[model samples]
Target chain A: MEELKQAILNKGVVVSNGVLKVDTFLNHQIDPILIAQMGQEFVKRFNGKEITKILTIESSGIAPAFTTALELGIPFVFARKKKSLTLSSNLLSAKVHSFTKNETNEITVSKDFILEDDKILIIDDFLANGEAALGLASLVEQANATVVGIGIVIEKSFQPGREKLEQAGYQVESLARLASLENNTVRFLEEVATK
Target chain B: MEELKQAILNKGVVVSNGVLKVDTFLNHQIDPILIAQMGQEFVKRFNGKEITKILTIESSGIAPAFTTALELGIPFVFARKKKSLTLSSNLLSAKVHSFTKNETNEITVSKDFILEDDKILIIDDFLANGEAALGLASLVEQANATVVGIGIVIEKSFQPGREKLEQAGYQVESLARLASLENNTVRFLEEVATK
Candidate 1:
């Protein structure tokens, strides 16, 4: 987590009060080494319990989720944002609203992927309002699967995402927790706690 | 490569003459161990290329690309299909037409990521009409970077993708080459040749 925190401080761009752009290493442009380390960190954090599969949303969530699944030696399934023609009709879906993009997308996964006895670990790049995470959990529940926990690479602690997931009775583990992005400065939750 | 070919024959679903659904392991629901093996295979295939970075499109392309970048100890960048609010105006953009979806997407990458004198290896999940691969090559060219070659996980040999890329004067390495999908059977090019 130190490397990720350092990367955020060094390469992360604070666009505004609540927006932190980590396109250089996290989302748009990815550092595979760092991503693998974070995936290992997630594996270490969630050392216990059974995880049959790793679930995530499409695009940004695929890399970290993939790496974690690789480390865990499990399969990962990503929920597609748009329903493609190739996708089968047997699907478990949930509507998710993105605060960043300011649009609602119906994310879906094939019902054939998530089985009734499966234990799912949901992973994603960023957690702000918990809409995406909650939506993923809903998909797992629809299939009568067990929700293992939520693993996040970066969490905006100033937001209500963590609290919402905790309220929903899901364990949330975030590698990097942002305390604030005010005045063009990147602040970590641990840094603020030590003060 | 044999494992990949076997996986295709066993799990790959042929929707029609041209459409092969590999959602079971290659795309929708990903097998991480197999993906890591494919990544290592790519490293072996593109050995001594001096690749400084791995380039891929978002979603389906990220897994194999990430694993390849991890094996190569290089960074990987995925082009965003839709421009988000956080993305900057300075970008390297290209228009790619998706034949399956019957839509065109203007994929873009941050200008800060791709640089001059960078040796990039392009990776993707599927190669059909060569639109996505060509669009990716254009992005690298716009940045004045050198494209070492293109690595594809699955290539429809009967399609025009490889021919177009080869005619464009780029070396392409496809892991699994499909000769035909007629009569709902997955036929590999190697199998066809041996017969």
Candidate 2:
């Protein structure tokens, strides 16, 4: 988590409106080594939760989820952002609104992927509005699976996403929490010490 | 490779239009152990290439690419399927036509990610017509980088993707080469022996 905070300070850029972009190493251009480290951190944070499956969204969320799943030796099911020709089948779906894209789209997971007894660990790259993570949790409940906990790479503490998930009675843990981005200077909620 | 073939033969379902759906293990619901095995196989097939980076498309391609990158100790950059609100400037863009979705979309990569001296290895989940591979190659060229090779998990050898890349003078390697999918039965060109 300290490494993550340092990486955000050194490489992250906020374009406008408190939107922190760590795509340099987090989303678009991935550093799998750092991702593996974050996976270790997530594993330590949610220790002994007995995570059976990892649930993530398509595109950005796959990186950390894949690394964590590999470290945990578990399979991951990524919900499709859109029901394409290949994914037109029985699915558990929920609508999610993206504040960045300003659009609402239905995210779906195949019905065969998640069974009733599976324990799901939901991970995401960014947890801004919590729509994507909640959408994944929606599918988790639809499948009658137990929610272990939600692991987030970066969370905007100024936003209401953590509050929303907490109100919904889900355990949420983020590696890096950004307190503010006032004047393009990113500040961390908790001061992270270097190792 | 034998494990991949067995996974295909046992769990892969050949849907209509000769589309072999291995979403059960390869893409949608990903098996991390099998993916790790395939990554080691990639490390073997692409031996001594001195690949500096791995390039792949978004969503489905990230799983195998993640494992392969982690195995090879190289970073990977996934080309964004669409230009998002966060990724708005300084991008190397190329238009690609998707046969599955029947539409053309511009795939963009951040200009800051790739360098002129970077040697890239492009990997993908499936190769039918090679649009995604070619699109990634376009981005590699735009960065003034050298492409070491193209690696595919399943190449529909009946299609023209391999031929097209070979004609383009690219070293294209595939783990499992499907001969055909006649009568809803998937057959591999190279009959992989189980390990």
How far is each candidate from the true structure, as Cα RMSD in Å? Answer: 1.8, 2.2
What's model 1's lDDT at A32? 91
TM-score per candidate, in order? 0.97, 0.96
Q: Per-residue lDDT tens digits of candidate 1, residues B1-195?
A: 988987887788889989999999978999999999999999999998899999999889999999999999889999988777778599899999999989999999988889998999999999999999999999999999999999999999999999999999999999999999887888888875221
The fraction of reference interface contacts (C-alpha pairs within 8 A across chains A and B) present in each candidate is 0.94, 0.88
Q: What is the interface RMSD of candidate 1, in Å?
A: 0.7
Interface RMS for model 2: 1.0
lDDT of 2 by residue, B112-139 (tens): 8888999999999899899989999999
**Model 2 ranges off by over 4 Å:** A192-195, B192-195
Leading candidate by lDDT? 1
Task: Score chain A of each prediction against the true chain A by TM-score and list the results.
Answer: 0.97, 0.96
TM-score of 2: 0.96
In model 1, the runs with Cα more than 4 Å from the true position are A193-195, B193-195
Please report the candidate that would top TM-score against the real structure: 1
Query: What C-alpha lDDT values do all the predictions have?
Result: 0.92, 0.88
Clashing pairs in 2: none
